[model samples]
Target chain A: MVTVTKPLSSTDSPYQSRGLLSTLRRSPLTLLTHLSVIVIVVMWTLPTAGLLISSLRDKEQLAVSGWWTSLSPSTQRLMVRSVPPDAQLEEGGRYVLRGKVSDDQALQVLAFGWSSREPAAYAVGDVAQMRKGQTLSISSNGEYELSSPEPFSGARGKRLFYTAKIPPRFGLDNYREVLTTGGIGQSFINSLTVTIPATVIPILIAAFAAYALSWMAMPGRGLLIALIVGLLVVPLQMSLIPLLRMYNQIGSTFGVDAKSYLGIWLAHTGFGLPLAIYLLRNYIANLPKEIIESARVDGANDFEIFTRIILPLSFPALASFAIFQFLWVWNDLLVATVFLGTGEQQMVLTARLREMLGSYGGNWEVLTASAFVSMAVPLLVFFSLQRYLVRGLLSGSVK
Target chain B: MTHLLSSLVIMLLGVAACGFYFVFSNWLLLRIFPVRRVSLQQQAVNIQRAALIRPWLFLAPALGFLGLYLVYPVVESVRLSLFDRGGDAFVGVANYRWLFASEEFQESLLNNLLWLLVVPACSTFLGLVIAAMTDKVRWGNIAKSLVFMPMAISFIGASIIWKFIYEYRGEGSEQIGLLNAVVEYLGGTAQPWITLHFWNNLFLMVILVWIQTGFAMVILSAALRGIPEETVEAAVLDGANGVQIFFKIMIPQIWSTIAVVWTTITITVLKVFDIVLAMTNGQWKTQVLANMMYDWMFRGGGDFGRGAAIAVIIMVAVIPVMIWNIRQANAQMEGR
Candidate 1:
């Protein structure tokens, strides 16, 4: 049998001892590996990064430009109506019309013109000769002046067009809007409601079951374990229809709503149990048998030993399962859509995000913010408890 | 706000009730056959009997949920599949016949097959390559974390992210989507990606691949690290190049793990619904079995028979994998 050992580090490899020439020869391959890994990391990370960046961008810029371009000042062609002719005053014997082209102080004008046909006909601060001996000039800071040798005659303000560089704007407006008017805040609470009980209940139930399956000398234990392993892959599709019918039947019989929090929570627990039992059993079984035997010898009952001994000892496994259940329930759409009500009050984050995807299909500002809001909790749980999460996955599958 | 508060209270009550059952049942069991009150000879027998009943008490709630949520529905779904749309009448094999003959079912089946073929293979391959590559680098952990990050985001959210990338615009306009922007930059026209027939299926598959590759990498990386150092030392001493060592030595050693990752992804691929639903809702022939099953469940008020039929089809596809898992588990238990 091959024995597991510390993975061989590149520096310790025999070939590295052959001297600088061989190391030099391998440098390009090392460089290629690093380059490819960076490319892969960027490719993997860019989409979510885009979502996050887009969510914080000013809604108008988010609509007009890509998130990657959000770091740079983008050029925009804008038209603003100058104050009506009544507001023009005589200055140095010239009836002048003066106004800032835009309220945004960050906007820097690159060019300006009076007519649409030549929107950027003149450079910043260059005087453009207009009709009737009127002269128009725009400064880089979006101030424009139209001076006429004669009095300005138009009753309506002249429509002046200018090309300006809009500085990149970022804010929390999208998140604010989505959380309030877009109904994501309600859904966030709903997700927590569904996830917490659904996550906690199964761990309690599955821990006892896993303990029983592991240590107890019971008949059909092997068969029971195998059944659970088989149940692990049973497509949740099979459960949706019959369970829906059952829930409706029971609801009608009891004069209660067919779709309710209790129902979905129960559904999540049931669906999550097989894996929970399987994972916890793998852990609980491997625990040294001595502790439990010693506890029993001290006259402790099975429940006492379990509560005092197994539960505390299995903290890592419990944590692993908790993270798994939390992520799964929080990220679940198919189960939530089927089992929970879709009212504003009952809609979970994933389901709400789906509805937003349909209703706010083209509104990237809304979509990006809502997606990130929904992703926030799971991502936080993932990054912080990532060690336990990875431990759970490795134990769940690899062993 | 009141509704959320009430639900929180109810959830705490439920947790308390679960705790009470365990404590109460165990307490009652000991009270019924009081070890201190009985004769010493009878006490030994009582303890033996209580032990026999104790496992059942521990197993009760889990078994109830498994039966109600998983096992019963499976059997009932098959029964429902044999009935009419409302499940009011017995219509043996009729829904099955309809399932076999329907054009939509054929489309979904074809799409599911393509998904089954593509998603698992791509995810596992990319994961294995990333796993192998990351192991040699100093900043591997951080790179691995970024790749694994998508595994946290919901499929619906990922679809939105990808949708933004695949966003399109009319010609002579600025393309805001990354894909279209890149395409436009390369002097190629941007096409609406998810509406293209047949090819759209591949586009949807890419999302699942992106999410699942991280999972495959995590599992396979552990397997790669588990390879005995002597094997690689022998390979290196034999003058094998990096690629040869990877394929010939590293992969063969981790073959079982690769199978585990591949099959796990295959199961995930079969259940993929939210991506299709949020992306195209199975438009443009991107229909898949899971999404089709969800559609039939509620389409036209409801069709329980047809919905269950589709679910059964998905279940049937999973049975082989189920059997393999059971056998592997049984073998492990026996070895223990």
Candidate 2:
């Protein structure tokens, strides 16, 4: 027998020399791995963090800049009404219109400019004086001046610069508004109605198809499988018009109509079937034949073989596909729009999210919270059934 | 009467199995493939026999549904594909020619090609790497789950999430996207990442890749586990280090599993429509086949025939991949 020879001559046993913690600490890959873990966790959480914060803060703060800039107060230059345009007061030599505008603190005004595009470069408490055809003069608190042969509005309108202190405040108002005002709560229920049935029916129907296709001795099985696989690429868009026609015909036959939850659900199930059957068939077919044969020998018929033996063994695959189907159906907007409602009762979470994006997209807090709310169920489902996802459901079953 | 009861029981059992094929295949091929009628006549098979009635009993419901839902619509879609939206007149493949001549449709096809070539390749590669890296670690499963989390998210959800990441604001306004927030913090202006045309399409691709990477990892991880540990130890004994063992031995062994994982994701990437639809609305030159089909069929020209033509194109594109998948699956089945 040719035996392999060892290498690494004259090396001390590193495991013996170093403790596990010490070795782990020194291992660069492990260190890098941990660092990446932290980086990723933070990256995933931070936007949500900022979004939550921005939502809690005053809406004005959200508009002026990013939530991060909320760390310091934001400044704006405004021409505050000095005694309004109509208010007149006589003091000493003539009439002096007086109202104080001041911005000072850690958030003290730096500079004010004539336009919002150039809000800075002229400091706070600066006064520009002008009279047309005479001389226009402008002076800052720093005694900087601009003078021309012509007078200004002496009044291009007085530009006032003052930084306002904004304190961080937290509230559940965004969630509340999204829930109550945005009709998201109703959409959430609608989405669940669509998603749950769509997911369950396909899986239930496909499970049987898969078992018969994979295990049951049946003629034309290969052709059926091929046909289903071919249908996998048939875009749902192609069938919408035809399906609606069928739905209309069927509905009228049964006193039903063009748009309803049933239409959306059935549409989704049909759309979801090709992949579900393909996936479930692949998984069930790959399950150990001997176990199934053993069950058969034990006097369990096909139905009993499926329920007791295959169901438990196939949980991981079923769960994985369930997650897939659930997510797809939950987030579908097109089918719902076509077959279901434009009404409040008919909108799904995705459609609601679209509306929110169009109208309140600039509101960081509302958008973030609403987005996360839309994301919440999927995240929950993903995390819960995630273990089954890693299992090789097809392993030890196929070639 | 007893024979009727027994055949009725067989029909009921057939219905329960949900495989109408067992009963109907014998009947369906009678005219289409046309088996020997003379032998059948000699054998005295009767079309009016209760046996024939029994088969139809089991087959009727499934066949009816299939015909109404699947087969009939397919036929209608084909016919619709050859006509205008109203089904008013024969367009005679005009939509197909128009689509073929249109630069926009051509661009969409190219984008689909990019998706086919790029998303699966990059996703599988990243997934494979991540799987291999984290396979042995104590926290590997956790890491895998975190990465795979995107997979469970609806494409729209992922789009929403990544949209926030790619959120753009005009110059002088704070970028609301998470990516822009970081870039701005690091003293860079917020760039319109997703609207950057081709690069933006790649940005959309990242979401698919993110979703699929976990799938790749999970499958590839199983393949990695199936790598015989003894073989690995033996390689080590031959003075092979981690890199050499992985390249020379481990890779060669797990090549088939890699192919399976790669092709599965490739098929999925071909069907990716929702992500692009949700994210950019296929604007700024990011249209793909499915989205184009929707726009043409539903919104713009209402050209059903062209829509079917594109759907057919996708199906044709997928045929080779399906064959490869089946062959590999068959091999793997026999291996077991």
Candidate 3:
């Protein structure tokens, strides 16, 4: 038994180690988890990818094929027919000539064969021998000549082999098209017009409300907060028609039209206010009670406390909510559509994305590339301002 | 001279009264802040009247704005619910009577009930699972952020994203939607997913769930992290295994937080319109109350009474959940 005991050594540790990819492969569960991450990323990004690949290919190819097909080598068959017998070439006792259908258009020939059915199994300079001392030699580009003791009845053509160059992946063309011809550029501008004021007006109103709600000892202050909190759950859907009618009524009264940018902006501001105030108030109320107390002790007014102390500390919340409201308003379509118009002057980017999807359903390239173009700003904003969304942004604002 | 002077004085007084609202609300905000003013401190023996009038002053503009927009709509919805399409005749409870009487409204009501039940519950459950699973991983933040990224997208964008996933093409045509492509790949005939009635409603609900799960996960993940170490340790000392500890200690402690999350998502689920609109246009029995109300009032040639009736019903359904949520939120705030 003692003799059968195995020796232990540092090099013989039971753990498997693959160095670089060790974490990736260790446990079956980890592998699955890693795979899940890959899957989720793929799941999230695949449609976008399909949209992109579809956009770049020719419309017929997109319609007939899957984007995944583009990953594999594409093949095509053509009947050369000796380039018409009158044009057959003669060179150095042999007929030879070469020209492409187009000037270096990406694809190059692969293996080619002579049989009509076996299109890619033969090559250039192959001779087709016939009876009575007859022969026909064909070049890669359907150039051929026949020298025979007996006349040839049919023109000869040879299949060829040359690897085609698929062009480099500079996929910016779809993006360019989306920007220029897709009307997304104008929609981009429209979205900005709707979003900027929609964002600013809320912050402006909410900041003031937040200050009052957080600090003011008004009558029914608790009740007011309660009512606002109660209002938070009121579905905006409930108000859509009434708001529109009200807008129509007010507009008619003021001689303003039914659907102006002003109407949409005000509508968005009203919609965004509850959440804005709630978020801002939560952050503001959490501020160090001492700070506001000290500010009050220092003889500053509530407005001054808001401007000087509370606002500075609440920057992260403001930024986070701003990103929220901005992204919300920027990506809004329904309000803009019902309140605005389909006219080029009023269409938002989201409305434009919808139109593209509606009209060009099979046009994957336009949709994906255009959608990504629309997402560009929001993604930038989220990534840039996300650092401010740290865990402690609300800490020390109040205790 | 007397008549002209009296008229000018009344006009001036009216203008002053109008101007005072802004000053008043501002003063009210000032008074609540409780900051010590040097001017006031110097005259501490004589408390200025400005301090007494502030909150009323500060609250006026906000209240006015709230009254004009937020409060007005809510009241008008309840009032409008009782009237006819034209809002000309007053008929008490007739709209409610019709809402309960109509099968279309009933169907919408049922869909909304399903939406309220399924969207939040599924989203929150999935979110909890994701947050729980991802929390143990090294790249949890990245995972959470990637998931939460959908929450950042507007309902419209998310709806469009899912539309591509649920997109349908006819027989022999190539499937553009990822889901349909998978079906074709698996040798199964492609399905028009959004036309599948009950399941299609779920399919539409999925977009809302997808967007919201991230929100639930982030908030719940934070709540999970906020849980006290000692409580967990004590439960561990009592020999609670991981599952027991999670169920007994962690979940119970985080119950309020979970409630807050659940209620927030529930409220969002109640208001969900964009996803349903973007995906199916509320066709094929996928209409929820909000979208149905929208269609009735705004799109289907404008039936204000029915729309407002639906709106009130939605509000009635949501208020209890909203109250519970605010209570929990305030409790958590006070607890902190």
Candidate 4:
């Protein structure tokens, strides 16, 4: 029988190395590593998780409580007004005012008090002394009863305070409100509108350019490739002032609107081309020389070889670049803010979210929901095509 | 609804137009050259001529966009920096003079320096440590994914997420923010985290670190895995401890990769705008160069000269990295 042995690399499973596994098992370091990793993972994910949880919580509850307390019932101090003298009824020779402290049937009142200074002074079912000859008591089920020996006489009802344990409530109300009233729905559409064309156009343009740079034996290919690598790091800030000026000049000469979807699309395509071309060229050049040579031998022109063979084979690279460009254009605030107008019609999700942050800074309910609305598409893309994203990152930066 | 429909139409038209350009141009080139049917010598000449012209056809649209958008803007920005706010009169370094003298500019510069120093280092270090640690664990992929999730979020989205964590309530009220709630639980007082001078800059940096550490981790993890096992086995045979192996053997091998991650994050740090703009809008000493440049662009009917000068400053800062990148790429190509 023939025996085969494979060489082990650093990527090999530790379990495959019996000595390493035994040592790892013998030491406490493994435990520490696992524990610390768990901690780091929690620290990294908690903020986004909190935002997600908060966006689903009741807006009123979201305002008063932290998101950590979202899964369990939260204790909240609340107040209710008793019935006035006109609504009082004679019960067993006493005037009584009876009502539920809250409309929520599920609320469990833990304590009750007449004064805000000590909102939880008395336990549930305890009768407390009142200013007049009145006595008050609250049940755990948010029921309250007030009675007076002689008769209740007042224009307004007396204020009673209680602390209630509210059951955790989760819903899509925040998303609904933001989408309908907060204008995030429009901005979501705007983001998609900006992203799809920006991504597709650049991929097509860069793919052609990359094919030429890779296989076409063109003059200046080296210089062009170097130029692209240099352009990869050019700050987008450098492009803004001049482009704005050019667009304005063009707008005046042609009497067209300065900020249009066409202008932003073109702008995105330009800014995105360098990285797109660089990544695609890196991928395409490394494709097997034999495939292209054989195709050429079979009398296939460069265009047919590219369209039929190289393009299909380059799907992984294309998908990765597509994801990168999509996330970039979708989540972009600076480019969108600069190239596009900030009107209600033109505002993308990031821009709208920023405006909301300024206008509704305190409204966490709105802000969290809108932020998630802006985040949802990218998060979906990230989770679904993460493999391609990582591969792209590896190829793009790690030579 | 109408807005969406119109945008959809435009998107379709734009994509169709790009597709048509490539196909039509290629067909036209082939038709003009007519390499398939002609005299032998003529056909050979036509093939060579078409080979020369076809690549340009493939390259023209991309080059046009790059030139018009990136290259032209660079030169125009420098020229605009020399001109007045209206971009008509040549003022000759007046914007640079004003930039140096301005207190806000100095403040922004200092804050940017602090951000540049802290964010990249923290993120890279944390990422390296996490990557090393996670490699040994069984659930490492899951852990890495959770840590890397923040990268998917926009800077604005991350700002909001962290802002919620750093939220503050008055002294007597129940603290809704996690940081303050923790503080109160730990017998300390809740304070506004983002408004505190000097420290608030650190607070903003934390958000970026949180977002970028994942990027650093993913890249460095791959680098770590690429290390040959024989070297690690040798280290183990030599009785080197885990820390010694990590620092002495493993780290040295991945230094270039670490540099790559660090420089990438540094470039990102230099251009960070959305977080600051969303969190504090450069209030409370959190101003950065990108945000400041954006501010000057439209602060009061816009000061184009100052804005473009600030952009030039950013461009100057990036040039070294740019040159380094080109050198690295060229070296890699030559090695290949």
Candidate 5:
């Protein structure tokens, strides 16, 4: 029995390794998991990828061809007029009309035909026979020579149809156009204007509030905390009408524009406060109480202890909230549309994108480029400081 | 350029103003209290007074902003909902009555409910699946980051991305929109996706779900990682397979986090406006509450009463979740 067991164990070792290899190869669940993840990742990624790719594509190509086809030279059918009859001159023995079908120099003529029915019937560099003993030769360079036994006589030159292989052209022309002409350049500035003060002021106000709510022995502190929590989900729609009226009243009282940058900044600061205070307070409250207590016992005032210690210790929380407010205020469309004027001077990036959606809906080149310009800063902020963002989310939501 | 510079200056001024308030108020409190060289009894009184005054001082700016912004708006929105379009006359529930009677409001309500039902559930479910699957993989962080990347995109930007995906040309034209291109490639005729009535709402909701799935995944992934290894070991010892461990042990442990994710996404869906505004603009029967409120706010010189009423409806829908959130916070505070 001992001998049999020893042999069995020895045999099982080799079989076990082979079995593990086979299982790894044959695991349908693992394969399915990987495939599904790939599919999801692709689905999640393709939209933005399309946007980026489409933004760089030539405007004409973007209109006609799918962005997927932007890399390959797109085949297009075209009709070009030969040199007018007056330009035809006797060359050697036959009357010849010589000119380039396309003068742009970007299009490479692939084929040519005299009739519209079969525009690409004759390959480029081939002489095609015409009705009246005429011969038309077109080259890959788009130069064409039309010769006829009889002198070419007409008010207009012969209509030549050819297929051209237009090269794939990609550039920053779309961005240049959108920025200089599409009004996004101005909106980009407006977005920053709204975002900067909106982001900074809220942190200052909320940090103090958070410090007070968390560490101070204030009466009604519990009530304020609960109030902030409740206000966390208050839809911004609830505030627009009232705030608009208030701003209008103040503007009329002072004879200033109702939707100035200051009003919108205050509006954003107001809208962003509850979450700011809540997230910061939660983080500030969780600080090791011994530090504050020891500082207090050392005769440091609450103000001194907060400024000298708690503020510095709460850097991560502060950074996280800053990223949050920056993204929130930057991406905000509803608040901007309502509080900021829709005029060119005050429109923010999101608002500009929305307006462009209506006016430039069909122009994907403009739309994609403009959208990316607006999204660039946030995406930069997101990728660079995503850790803080995730940290903010984790602390702000679950706790 | 001048606009940009002025805004920077304003931002610095705002910061300086806040700093001045905090520093000056604290200085005044300290000077009045004089904790450094006072009688012991006087020091005690001074410290008490400063303690009482300092919290309010620290709290004053935030409270002032919150009061003027959130609390005041909520109260004033309720009042405005009862006023006329001009906001001068008392209408007294006339707007609410009109809202109940209007076909557009009903459509918006139904669509909002549809969005609330689908967006959060879909986003949370997708987020859960991704979080669960991405775990124990080498490239999980990269995959998770790609998924979460959409959360950084503005809704308007997302709408343009999706609008291009849904773009349609006439029959036989090469389908440029990705959806239509796929359909054509699969031997199906291209259909204008966002113009279809019932499905358009789903199309719009997909944008939200796409943006929100990453958020859900990150939060849920963190929660999933937090599951104790011993629980899985205990289950494995009981002869439970991977699926059983996942279903019974893992999901149950992270249930609260899932709830947190679901509720958060639900709140975002309630504010669904930009996508609808940009996509179909309430056309094709795709109006939601937020967009409808925005429309009424400005349609034909504006209807503040009806708009505020819609805003109030949105606020009312959020009240339950708000209560649940506060209760959750209170419970956690108790644990602390």
Candidate 6:
């Protein structure tokens, strides 16, 4: 095997053909490997890219053509009717019918046909002869007039088939509609109400707990740590029914609504505690022991030491957990749906998005824009503070 | 806008209250036990008392929340599973029996099994491959970042993204969904992928795999980088090829990390409710445990016993991971 690999030495390798004089020596396998990685990246990003592009495309065009063809003008075959029989008036010794063939939107008429079988048979502005003694005329701008020697008498308008070249239009109308009219705007505020406190409240509580777990000597610290770690993997589904019941009972006793912003904040705080404490404790414990020692020597109590020393020192960990909690609470649907009010005043963004999914499942424009709106914050957090996010992931998993 | 202002004010007040509690409580503790003013013996006693009391004070809020949110609910759920739908009468094992007998529950269990088997395996495998390949090329960080971008997306948002890709148009129309478009381009009839029987589950799993592979990649990529380079050099000296070195050298070193990523994704798969709830609403054989639990919770005036029982089932499914996590934490603590 070693002798057989002698000719494949790195210096003589065919893949390193980028320099010169090795045109025939280039390895297709290496090229293929690089191409495959590119393929994977494209595959991963294509779906979101589709959503973004489709969201921006004109809703009319979005319905028919794929987003891949979003840049090109879309061609649509439409059937519109001329003026009804009653609208027909005698003009120039012929009974005439007239109306605009297209809707209010500016559309360039590419072709027109009197028959459905050949929808685009006649070029724009070409008037076709009808089998009946009538002449048809259509303009590229979608205006049409039909004249017949015989007086037209029908209750329904005459059907005219045409192909229109709709320019590729893009706008934020979808987002505007969803935000202004879809109640997502209200839900955005509600999401903030849920996320801000839910993110901040836990850090304080967990910081205190983490300090105790990390430094303060207590009985059963190991068991407590173990328990919390085990709780880390306890599925959140386990807590829902009981917590809902508890909230309902408490709300009844207090004569208040159970699904309030405060309720979700507390619920989030509770559910987020285990991971927060676990991560923060891990970091706080790893702090150089000498700092806490020095503070102790200076007559600082545990509280002072924790606040003055450990809290500031654990900024990275705090930021890490804060982002984690923020994203978790922001992206949470099940918890928000269960604990928060579903009314227009209290529905969070995720719940709002899910509602949109049910009500407007077929409307891609609405779904994509609303989904993107909900995703915007987390994506911003992910991109802006990716260092801390990645660091948290590394510490959480690889530790 | 008024809502925004009020929420902001409430947030500030809440934060202020938390700060005040910590400061005032710590101040109270110090006042109650003045270590400096006492005699040496009394000071030591004060210090000990303060030390003992301080930890509890520090741990109180977190423990309270954890107890209320996690521990209490867990106990309450167990109690609830024994009670009737109204949670009034004791009904032992009836919910479990119903769960076992219901074809919907059985289908959900099978689907959960399929999700468990496929999502973690596919995500980890693809993650490993991408992590390894991306490490070799320039612009790898950007590629990794783009791939990891999905990690930040909500599962609901991700379902919408994938939903657009799975959008179906009738035959002879221009196929808009990417999957169907590609299928049509490749000379195959477009399939409404998410609605297909027995395979729609896999189609949904693809979205999760797409989302989670980045997670696995990031963790595994870090683990791969942590592997000492000397080992790979030695493997090369031993005549190991690229594939052999990867399988024999690098993977063995990061095997535990792989397990961590796998189990992490597994836990996520077990609790994945949003994707299914949004995608198909547990229809067409796509119901998983968590969504089914949610359905039972509020389907018709709510069925507490059945809901809690379903939760218990999910909890039971997660027990192995919980045990492993505890063992791992204990081991880490011991090592420290």
Candidate RMSDs in order:
3.3, 10.3, 10.9, 3.4, 6.8, 5.3
Q: Give the per-residue lDDT of model 4 (tens digit) for A1-399.
A: 110111112345574355545756776888788789989998998898899999999998999999998888998888878777788899999989898888887899999999989888999878998877789999999888989898877698889999989999999999999999988998888888888788888888899999999999888998999999988989999999999988988999999999988899899999999999988888888898899999999988788898999899888889989999998998899999988999888899999989998899899999999999999999999999988888788888835
- Candidate 6, position B29, lDDT: 86
Instruction: Give the candidate number with the greatest TM-score.
Output: 4
User: Could you report the DockQ of all the candidates, in the order they appear?
Assistant: 0.61, 0.17, 0.20, 0.61, 0.56, 0.56
List each model's interface RMSD: 3.1, 10.6, 12.4, 3.0, 7.8, 5.7
Per-residue error for A370 in candidate 6, Å, reads 1.2
Task: List the candidate 3 regions with Cα displacement exceeding 4 Å.
Answer: A1-62, A68-70, A74-104, A108-170, A389-399, B1-48, B91-94, B172-174, B237-239, B329-336
Candidate 3 docking classification: incorrect
Instruction: Write candidate 3's Cα lDDT for A1-399 as tens digits.
Output: 111111211132113233426755656666666566656545545544555565666543444445667665444454444343345456555444344532434654444444555555545556655446546454444344555443224464433323232333334677787788988887877777777667765665676677788787766666667777766677776666677778889889989788887678677778777777777777777677888899888877666777688777777777767777888788777678778878887788888877776687656567767777777788777656655443322221111
Q: Write the per-residue lDDT of candidate 3 for residues B157-255, one digit (tens) a residue.
A: 666666767777798766757788888889999898989989998888877877777777766776676678789889889899867887888888877
Q: Residue B229 in candidate 5 has what lDDT? A: 78
Q: In model 2, which regions exceed 4 Å deviation?
A: A1-20, A33-58, A67-161, A226-238, A248-256, A274-318, A392-399, B1-75, B181-189, B331-336
Q: Considering lDDT, which of the candidate structures 4 and 6 is the better prediction for this target?
A: 4
Count of clashes in candidate 3: 28
A30-86, model 5: which lDDT tens digit per residue? 666667787889999999999999999999889887999888999878888888989
lDDT by residue (B1-336, candidate 6, tens digit) is 566677677777877877888888888988998877779999888888888888888888788888989999999999999999989999899999998999989999999999999999999999999988777655567788999999899999999999999999999899989889999999999988888889999999999999999999888887787778789889999999989999999999988889999999999999999999999999988999999999999989999999999999999999988888788778878898
* Tens digits of per-residue lDDT for model 5, B305-328: 999999999999999999999999
- Supply candidate 3's per-residue lDDT for B291: 78
lDDT by residue (B228-322, candidate 2, tens digit) is: 87898899999998789888888899887777777677767767777877777789899898777767666663655677667666656676876
The residue pairs that clash in candidate 5, if any, are none
Superposed by TM-score, candidate 6 places the C-alpha of residue B179 at a distance from the truth, in angstroms, of: 1.1
RMSD of 4: 3.4
How large a fraction of the reference contact set does each model reproduce?
0.73, 0.20, 0.25, 0.70, 0.76, 0.72
